[model samples]
Target chain A: MTIGADLKQCLATIKSIEAGLSSLAINTNAEDEQRLYHEQMMVIEEIKQDLMKRIGEVEREEEQYKGF
Target chain B: MPEWIHIIYRGVLFLILLFLMTKLLGKKQISQLSFFEYISGITIGSIAAEVIMGLDNNIWHGIIGVAIFAVIPFFVEILSLHNKKIRDVVEGKGTVLIKDGKLLEDNLKKEKYTTDEILQLLRGKDVFQVNEVEYAVLEADGKLSVLLKKDNRPLTRKDIDLPSINEKEPHTIIMDGEMIDDKLASAGKNRAWLKQELDKQNVTIENVFLGQVDSSGQLTLDLYDDKIQVPKPQEKPLLLANMKKCQADLELFALATDSEKAKRLYAANARKLQESMDVLSPHLKG
Candidate 1:
């Protein structure tokens, strides 16, 4: 349950960060800043996906334990 | 079914369903997804996928499923638009984080924000110090809106009694040796005028890379071949001088060992020299 909650929080944080970065990219007056913001978002998204897979593995383990 | 045929059919179906749903829900639904809308999206996607793969099954089942999934969200969104209470319940409300330089503990707890999280958000906005913030709101869409203390805020030109900088967007007259006719017409210049301007600089249109007309009515030109024939003041000399002076100033905190500081000074000097060159380079005879 804790892992599930943490995973949800992580996903939410990732989405929020992505949204903020996207807005920054859109509103930034400088082209270089926009590019940096996009790059940061891509990195965050990769991290989010990895966390999601880890959470899935934890859940699978819990289910197997419960079956035993 | 052939792989190509299956792929093409699925693509067409996806497009049709996406179009129908987008039309039903407004454009805003794509960006702002409520919890119900989020679930509806997953459900609709699953139904669409089933329809695409369930070729052996009744085609009407897929059609019915798509229609049902699409119609429900369409009606809910429409109803929410008309009802404020329903909208608030679905979309959630904005929470206040700080008010009058005081952190709202209750609101912070409600939003699940630690002091560290708040600090992180402030730093993301370049706030650095929390005492400088007057008000901060955590918006419903999970975004921060910050208001800084009057004294801590950067003083604009207006605050210092200077005229406002012209904020008009610059127009591109020439891009990669090609003239933009629309921009030329808008700037009240013709092809003949452009040719005359190029002639004065002794530059052919083919040699030009980008030519922009700023709000000041100045034609800023960049050349394709950016080699400086004239011996201009080398930027490296000025950069070295500035670094030496900066290092001596104890308040500046600039160290001789700091390569980042040195690089920044070097780049600044290079940019200044580049700007000067951009202005005067055209006047210099080949």
Candidate 2:
């Protein structure tokens, strides 16, 4: 239960960060800064996807432990 | 007419005529002029000198002579523009002094340039060895143009097949403690933005001797007071370093965390950030 709660919190933080990076990418005037921010946002999106996958894995692992 | 009076009026008349004639002749540097233009220029000067000093018995003769010299060159230049043959005749063709690393003694002799002179011309172009020159032309302007052999040429970015970027020239935004409002517009920046940049450096516009904005939108300033050390603009490097630090923090968090799932999540994110950094290194470093 505790591990599931922690993973969910990490997901929320990652989502918040992803939004911040997206905002930065859109608002900046500098071409290079825009590229860097957009790239970073993409990287964070990948990490978010990976974390979501792991969240499901952790939850399933918890379910098995709960049954035992 | 008093001789002094004659000299004074002649000087004024010749001065006005000379100014007009110069305007008609166009602006070509003395060294860039052809053989005909060179002689005509000297003849015009001699005529003007004689007339201006009241030495020429007939002032009208000097005036007509100057007018003819200036007018002929003007017409010749126009004809040279429309006809290649006339241009070749007026400007003379460039003589090939060396070809395929071999001295063309016949061509050199035709141009009245000796082997020693050719060697000197090659040396002037920083080509020491005669064999290194693939081609050397004595241009019509008397300037030697030399092309080195492929093996002897200097390496450029294209030689190694590096990507080339068309970078815009840096705009001078400030000069001598005054804002160049016109140039600021070309740089795509406003006065308020410039003020903010100045504020960041803790320097006023009054103190800045020079300021330039590069293609990347970086502001660099040279202050009148050099003793006061203004901070170097390292925002790009600093931002890169901060991102790298954030990635390092994630790796550290992964190490310190006890939960296996959280550890894996942090490690994976850190690797993602590292990959992103690798791709962005060139732009950020630039």
Candidate 3:
């Protein structure tokens, strides 16, 4: 997949996972699972930021290729 | 029961059926055809031959066999167009045989291609040394696509710092003395304008065989009786606007990162851009 398409798909997957994470029933004893989800969210955010930067780079490259 | 009757019947039938089947399969060059398509062609040909020779057997059965083979590929081609995964599965994937001038033995084995064969392919591409290849891939169609290392690669205008002309698609304005009104309109011209341009050449539209206009609005005409003369440029113009934009982007990116490496690369690119502009300055001025 192209970087743009991969970013879009990644964001879609993250959104679904976030929704599922919110729906999970947690108790006081479920601190470990909640912590894992928190870490996962942080990683997802990092990936989102990285993908955005890469997408910008691709767009710049494309602009350079234009008019010929 | 006559042999000649069967020969004529089957000959005509085969001609029509094979043409239709090939058309259904779509246009693919011999080298571009996948292994699946190649095998399918063999099977279809065998069935066709059977239909031609099988005078004692049922002709409908042979016809049905050919039909099934053609129909499967047609649907497969359609499915490939829609779904990438199916396309990859159906057509197979391009395998990387060499990376960074290193031979990938596992991939070569997986592809079932020998080193001698790979070398032959590379030689065909005018690549003498394996060390000169940065990347070599065996494409899904069984053809090799090689990316040579920097020194082995062709020098472009960017390498030598030369300004480029923006490329344009040429539109056919006239064909065989007939004005292609749609093409002329698409190029933002009319018949009246075309006739006026023809008058410039001391010719009429009726005498002109073919006329085309480029994106730069340069009209080239081929007369029915006259040979057209187009001069070749002394130095090919490179589009420095593209290079300037990239250099500007790199500058911005370097400023944002504050990385010495990025800064150095940006400076190098900027220098190259300036050199290219300088090289073309004389020509542009003239």
Best by TM-score: 2
RMSD list, candidates in order: 28.3, 6.6, 21.3
Higher-TM-score candidate of 1 and 3? 3
A1-68 per-residue lDDT for model 3 (tens digits): 44345434444544443343332212111344345435544543444454345556655665642221
Candidate 1 or 3, higher lDDT? 3
Q: Candidate 3 residues B1-286, lDDT tens each?
A: 7898987898798889889878767786133467678778889889888778877767889889888888887788789989999988989989999999999999999889998999999999999899999999999878999999999889987788665544446799889998988998787677777777677667778777888875444467777875654332211123233334434554554465454754564455445445544543433332
lDDT of 1 by residue, B1-286 (tens): 6866875787697768768777777766576557666666677778777767766645568778777767876777788889999888877778889899989999999889999999999898998887889999887767788999999889986788653333346689999999999998776567887787677667888888988764323466788888823223233233333323322321232232244753454344334434433332221111
| lDDT tens per residue, model 2, B1-286 | 7788888888889889888877767676244468768878888889999878855469989889998888888888889989999999997889888899999989988999987888888899998899999998998878899999988999976888654444567899999999999999887788998999999999999999999987667789999999999887776676567557657766876887778877887888888878877765655576
Prediction 3 global C-alpha lDDT: 0.65
TM-score of each: 0.51, 0.72, 0.59
**Decreasing TM-score order of the candidates:** 2, 3, 1
- Stretches of model 2 off by over 4 angstroms after superposition: A1-68, B1-20, B29-33, B57-59, B243-286
What is the CA-based DockQ of model 2? 0.18
Q: Model 3 segments beyond 4 Å from truth?
A: A1-68, B28-32, B78-86, B160-165, B226-286
Per-residue error for B110 in candidate 1, Å, reads 2.2
Ranking by lDDT: 2, 3, 1
**Measured with DockQ on alpha carbons, how good is candidate 3?**
0.01
